[model samples]
Target: MTFNPYLAGLKTNAAEPGKGSSGNIERPQAVGNIPWQTRPAELTAFEMTLADALQAMFRDGVETLPDIVARLNASTVQHPEGSWTEQNYQSLMNRLAAGASV
Candidate 1:
């Protein structure tokens, strides 16, 4: 499949891929063949953006916490406190997961 910006689901299209043939970019409904899951409404905007940035970092093979924090600091996505530290990363993850029953 061709690279599509809509496939990321960050942008909505009039008609998504496999739903029609408007000749616009084809946004696949799944990632790695798994159906896309809806994000929880409880997550704040900062959390959502942070999650996206972390997802991109993981896809690029940045696994270590320090490295991830460093990359996040270097990127435009600022942490809620202005910068990401290993400590804050852990704290935020814990906080985000605290209310998550799943």
Candidate 2:
């Protein structure tokens, strides 16, 4: 599975309707722009090692799929502002599934 650096950096601020001191203010645009000055390259060796360890755990049936998902969700919650997303989840799952069949 391919990695998406863009999705890794995706962030959104909730739009709220309010007034400064008078009337209702306009809703802000839902822009998909990444706030980073520059996008970084591929994952580093440590990151790859971590990913590999997780993948191996999945591949070896060390944990059930649900357990893995739960752990991932917990991780996302613990690091809410970090670079984990649905795309990353799918990619990791796909890779693990493919590895399992091999």
Candidate 3:
């Protein structure tokens, strides 16, 4: 089995409703048996890229907790196919405060 980005995107959105769709209904899907714990670096880099892209997209310069959270939320909404959630955003903010990247 192999990883299908389309199916993964669908699964991500399915895990949480109201996030919208990925528009891959007719695409042939691939299945995979990869372990979640085996992808830390990949996941982290992906998240970092997503956060950076989101920041670039809405760059007014973050100055406060509320502002950061709002921007994160907007980014999550914008990229509904990614693994962004309220908890993940909070964790990212905590990591940032602790001098770490997403």
Candidate 4:
């Protein structure tokens, strides 16, 4: 399992959309060139963790599969087998894309 810093303040099962402790703030619209994408109906725990890590990495200018794998390994996150390799990382990506948690 990975320890993602990004997930620290997020609840696994969050409140209904637009509801929050601060009281129903409006959700922001897509800005600039960022296109709005449809949300997945649900995600597994592993998907959530991976999404968090990937978002953080992208914000930090981390791109490319090899680099992503390296950063993931260096962080608290590890692939299911233990550590990450490019091949395994791609394999996992494929499985996840196919809607498989493993």
Candidate 5:
């Protein structure tokens, strides 16, 4: 947790112009990458993970198991476990049937 831009060669008062140590402009951590930012690489929703989205889709569609799995693999949603094979899809349903949430 030890961090301070001064230790990484930045001036002790360094920050955005006119917003140094006393002006409240948030400083990026000096230990890692400079000019830090928060952004999603693939732009997925934060409201639910892939598993929850899959379960909801399956419940709403009355398709066959294979059809459901195929749609899941083809949809815009990304799988957390690489790809969703038939075995993995079955196990996901099994867990849901046993009252699991994402």
Candidate 6:
């Protein structure tokens, strides 16, 4: 959260700084962050980049997690963090499903 210069002063409108800091921690979307660990990143970019590929595969009638995993592993898609495993892919899907808008 400290990395975002834009969000430098975007703290809760606390009655007092020290006291307000005691509230439950919250964070904006952790999507396509550039200077990592900060404000809401460009989630749409992240989504569309991956979604486009997935959509194409689905349109081609690809189904099942195993198949998807195999295709992703074999495809030319390059995840910023590296290769995809079944577990990591499933976890990512879960994160996307949680609240990621189209």
Candidate 3 lDDT tens digits, 1-102: 222343332346564344445753422233323444223223455556666765775676665556655665665444333544666666765765454434
lDDT of every model, 2 decimals: 0.66, 0.47, 0.50, 0.66, 0.54, 0.62
Q: Provide the TM-score for each candidate, comma-separated.
A: 0.55, 0.26, 0.30, 0.57, 0.38, 0.49
Ranking by lDDT: 4, 1, 6, 5, 3, 2
Which segments of candidate 5 are over 4 A away from where they belong?
A: 1-62
Please report the TM-score between candidate 4 and the true structure. 0.57
- Tens digits of per-residue lDDT for model 1 on 42-100? 45567668889999999999999889989999998887676778998788788766544
In TM-score terms, which candidate is top?
4
* lDDT tens digits, residue span 1-48, model 2: 234343444532233333122354433362333354242444545455
Which residue pairs clash in candidate 5?
none
Candidate 6's clash total is: 0
For model 5, where is the 10-residue window of minimal lDDT? 35-44
Model 5 earns a TM-score of 0.38
Worst 10 residues of 4 by lDDT: 30-39
What lDDT is reached at residue 37 by model 4?
Answer: 25
lDDT of 5: 0.54
lDDT, candidate 3, equals 0.50
**Candidate 5: deviation at residue 3, Å?**
42
Query: Which should have the higher lDDT, number 1 or number 5?
Result: 1
Choose 3 or 6, whichever is better by TM-score: 6
Note the clash tally of each candidate.
0, 0, 0, 0, 0, 0
Candidate 4 residue-wise lDDT at 1: 25
lDDT value for candidate 2? 0.47
| Winning candidate number (lDDT) | 4
Worst 10 residues of 2 by lDDT: 12-21
